[model samples]
Target chain A: MNDTLMTDESRLRREHHKGHYDRETVYRILDENPFCHLAFVQQGQPVVIPTMQWRVGDMVYWHGSSKSRIAHGSDSAKVCLTASRIDGLVLARSAFEHTVNFESVVVIGEAQRFEDTAQKTALLESFFDHLFPGRWDALRAMTASELKATAVMGLPLHSASAKIRRGPPNEPEEDRATPVWGGVLPIAMQFGKPLPDEFNQMPEPGYLARLRTKP
Target chain B: MNDTLMTDESRLRREHHKGHYDRETVYRILDENPFCHLAFVQQGQPVVIPTMQWRVGDMVYWHGSSKSRIAHGSDSAKVCLTASRIDGLVLARSAFEHTVNFESVVVIGEAQRFEDTAQKTALLESFFDHLFPGRWDALRAMTASELKATAVMGLPLHSASAKIRRGPPNEPEEDRATPVWGGVLPIAMQFGKPLPDEFNQMPEPGYLARLRTKP
Candidate 1:
């Protein structure tokens, strides 16, 4: 079972237009994407880093080196977590009118570093399983030292917002008559055939067929 | 003619990794996606915002209010820009081993706001045309005062990094022996029929067909 459920909100404002507080849309996007961009400052300089992340309910978690410049010595802080999925390319007759349809989430809140052993262990398990299910359980549990060395942080979706733009171009009236190519270039993410890691010993049957039946 | 070119070494480093740096691969992902996540700090806290962006050669530009919290009063000076594409979902025989294949870029650098009249005018033209070509030239130019009110910023592709995880699950030797299902769930982005703005009067062919040719 995954903890990445979305919290519900009924009164989403217009500016916050696509801000979905619903679990269905939120979890669907979160689960389909594995990486997220995190922004924070170090010594007054803004820096953005890309890292693997897992979502638990409305909260997101990620890890980095404790000695890293951005997280190591900073005071308690709030940072932004964003996940976006690009749907298509919007080409207009005029070069100036291109646009794209997309879905994205912006989370603004404080991130709390996980220090306790029990919580860290649980989070690690949740994260690993979230990334590669059952792998965590099959592997040896994290030793006390490994847990101590890793830095894990969690940020809640307090000021969370999501934006999505879809469909075609909104060209001006008369300009539509201009002779130019216009339309969407649909794009997709497709999976290549799976290759087993070198360390794997067993000659197993393909797993691709299995994934379809389960989800 | 596109302004978003990636040439800075640092930006390239931050964006290109061993398995993900091929130009054809990078550009394929870049041209197809429309939205990016901007990470910055406000009042000692990190805030991530989702916004529309365009790539023109090496530089990526984003626009917003001059008095906005994340941009106008940003403390770190530099900002982090990230874009990610989720290719497919992985479902392994074991529930704990699910994963996804993805491509992503993390950009780190200082953002210089556009203030010069000439630069602002050019940038605005690029911005407008980048989103909707020919529209800038066709529409009335922004008055001096109107230009003064808009804020634009440029972040070089310096100190960037790109990390990508692709292909299928690396199932454990033991799990491979299990009969449970496993495989990938592909994700794609496609454009729907274009919708003209209610206010748009003269309907030319519209911009949908032109965008369809994008990779």
Candidate 2:
């Protein structure tokens, strides 16, 4: 595999030192974050929709209602899919130097709809397994009609790049001696206690234990 | 104020019940979330960039490097700004019924740049006060050159809609008897303990106490 996945559109113009084109860096960001914002041109106007996304090998997939405008507009259309995670808030002595520590990946490609029912079913199963291993087999099987009502689309990672910022704030040389309190306040997404549905009769499964231990 | 702010493009087609066009609901979502994704068309290609956003009255503002591609492409151009927060993960007996509990606001409008220095300065100060009250004054003043290097843009909330989903998953009646464990896993963004810079000699400010007590 190539060391970098750089394309004309994926190149970073500003703060170029933070730009990363390695597959490992890009895939790591995609895998760590389950949510993404998908951008596509609709009716000659730009539209963006937030959706849950997962990766399978070199392709990233997201599902939506078959009848959704997102499904119709993105089918076989060029798109920009971005996954971002805010790691922390960097506070400097000066507001000008204050910034957020984050990891983000931008992938540009043409979205391809998966029309094969069997393939779609397997992919959906993997989505569940990716988030919660062993939970998919424990649940009821997906109905044929249910599969037909969902649209699954995938975008290859051919043109992908990652941008990351981390650590303490970068203070200006002259302001380094300022007495102002400055540092990093970490930000994280955490899972609270799981509340069982009112109708649920089963005890919590083992797969859910991971959520409690996850950082 | 009008009861709703619905335009042809802002109306939701599928799951119309989840759509909210009222200003109160729309404004609440924008105010609660500090980050947003801005989408715009650049040379006929759709592009999405994640940035920090703040809402002041009927307008939402974001800043970026003046020389960045996002600034150049979105200047006086139609753009879509979306602020989303995932409340929880809804789990159902069947994968088909799985969904996320979230509050999202999508605002479509032309991004207008703020060229006046005084106006930009006030807006930038408000941005800090909105996120961390009284912290702006504690920090060093922003330099003239720094202000010139940044671009501040605002979009009116004229064409805005909020979509919210909450509570347990809606499972089919027939599948209610399934023995699979199902429920909602709550998700929240939290602030960790503040880590002061290595060179800092000042104690933490009172403004940071709010972060510790905030939910």
Candidate 3:
């Protein structure tokens, strides 16, 4: 992992030493989160784009419109990306001590735009398949013009770092005497009843079955 | 509701639309999400920070280290924040068409640092009550040094926009003739069993109880 991407901001410091960096830990966190906030500077100002992302080994891929202003110039510009998931809320005794337990990955690198049609198509296929195992095979082939209108960019994960904080809050030895109630108020994501599209003729996909059954 | 915030992004171009400025729809999505990616430019370079956030009325408060490098000029910095939640994964007949249904809020604003002690204390209290109710009174008060060392910033929700995409993929009518299977692979977030802190000596809070029983 690149040490440059790691910075110690006093307020959000790595607590419990669990929020440190390592390539293995970083990759796992990145894989778990499907969407990432891709940030870059445009016209000397900060711009953030929310998009779906897929990881292949040590590289991350994201697609954009051919006319996207930022996407067109990403090949030469510096980029910073952040992906996160709040697993639980750490409700400690003191209001000042309260914090949310989360896992987040940050990647800093220069993006390389993929220009080859075959390579872009392959990457796009993997991006879809990574989220839905067999969905890519169900669509019609991309037309030449359609292919020309889409762009894909790849950024290596070597300069990435993972920061995570889990469990309870950090209470001072002096404040431990307080009689306030304290414990973890875990956060969770739930899928509501599926609303099928007007055009969908069949039931949900099999992969969804596997996901729902997962503990 | 600011009409200027509703600019025409190519993906979410809604022309001559009214009632798109309600705060409930905008704030609900903002308050529901626990984490946000904050992007800013430092020395002509892009930087991203993932931090916990709370929405109170029309303002969002986020706190971090007073000594951190990212917030070096936050008082005068133009920041862009993006918050998102992935609801479900769309499994299309073709891999290229598979997509994820999601809700996102994007804000571009000038961050104003809160140096006043009273305002900072109030913001911190809101942050406390939002994270956990009835607990702020239970904990000890913050020390003068602690309050001084921490930096609190507020960005009004005036300049913001929310975007969402749901349901199944939109395929060409002619593609139905092809023999590819297509459906949605639903995605969801579900709460797991609460893991109490190893050092906890008191009972769990009531807020957590509701979280455990809710859908």
Candidate 4:
């Protein structure tokens, strides 16, 4: 198995017990979360933007409006990509011990922009198709002008690491018998319901309907 | 009465239609999301760390291990604080039109650390109590070492703006009739069943039980 190779940047320095290194763990977090915060330096100040990302093979893809600052500045620049889900709120028996149980992956790499128009066009279609098979075929094709206005970028996932914390509240043995409450409250992200467009006369896609429970 | 003041840094340059200003919308999004991505520059490179935060009046507070790099590096640094929730994945009829419906707030400011031990301890309690009333009182008292080992940082919410996109997919009329499916899928974050610690024997707190349905 090809494991994730940790670099100086990907290594964890604090609470090292929470660090994780393995392709299996990294991909699991990425596949489970569709949103991520992409961080990069701009004019010597750090800026982080939340965006939708898709993973295909060993590469992760993200796209936005051509006019967006991230679309223009992040390409070819060293960046940190982080996708994290708060699993639970760790309510402890001591104030200082309270913490959050979460799963996070941080990847450092250079973002590469798609140079070929056809490559960009095909990848964009794949982005939608990945969510629901045959869904892209039902939508109209992107026009020349439409494709020109979108910027598609990708980064290799070769340098990445996942960090996670999941457990019951950890408190000193002396503090355990305190009269206060202590435990973990689990959190989940779910899909509510799909609202079809008013003009639409099609049955809710089986895939979309299924998300109500699975999403 | 008093709304957040807008500055050049907090203003949106693209998709002006999606930008929202004022206290009502900004606080609504901030209060709902349990965690936020803290962005700061490190040695000229950008880094984004996810952490839990609490909003108290005009200030937002967060805490983590004192040994963490962010604890030391974020202080006095001009940082971009962002809290976002991905509402749903927008499945558009065109590749370029595909977008995720979300609500996000970005605030740019310098992070200031609480140097006073008592102040830090008090805020830490408030952070927990805000999540669950009387949560801090139920827990045992924090020791000196515990308070010293955590860093509490704050940023004012004076200059913040929320960006949101909701409702059905927006597509060109010409493309609407395509055989493909197009609509909005709603995403919701909620609390799951609480997992009590092995030693926990107190009646499950009503607040904790209500979260299973509300969180």
lDDT at B156, model 2: 88
Model 2 per-residue lDDT tens digits across residues A52-156 = 899998899999999987678542388889999998889898988999999999888788889899999999998998888877887788888888899999999
Which lDDT tens digits does candidate 3 get at residues A1-215? 45343444212343436554566777777777767888986545566767767888778888877777547643246887777777777766666677777888777777888999999899988876765577566667887777887878878875666777876778876666688665566666655545555556665666556556543
TM-score between candidate 4 and the true structure: 0.94
Q: Candidate 3 — which residues are off by over 4 angstroms?
A: A1-21, A73-76, A190-205, A213-215, B1-4, B7-24, B73-76, B177-181, B199-201, B212-215
Docking class for model 3 is acceptable
Compose the digit string of candidate 4's lDDT tens values, residues A1-215: 25655777778887788888787788778877768998877665667889877788788888888888777754238777888988898877778777789999887777887867899988877776767767777776778888888888887987787888989987778877877677888888888777777777777888776656663
Highest DockQ model number: 2
Task: Residues A1-215, candidate 1: write the lDDT tens digits.
Answer: 33332333222334355566555676567666556777776556555655667888767887765555344654457566767666666655454455566776666667888888898878878876665465555554455665666788888755555567777775666656654444555554444444554344444333343433332
List the candidates' TM-scores in order: 0.65, 0.97, 0.85, 0.94
Measured by lDDT, the strongest candidate is 2
Better of 1 and 3 by TM-score: 3
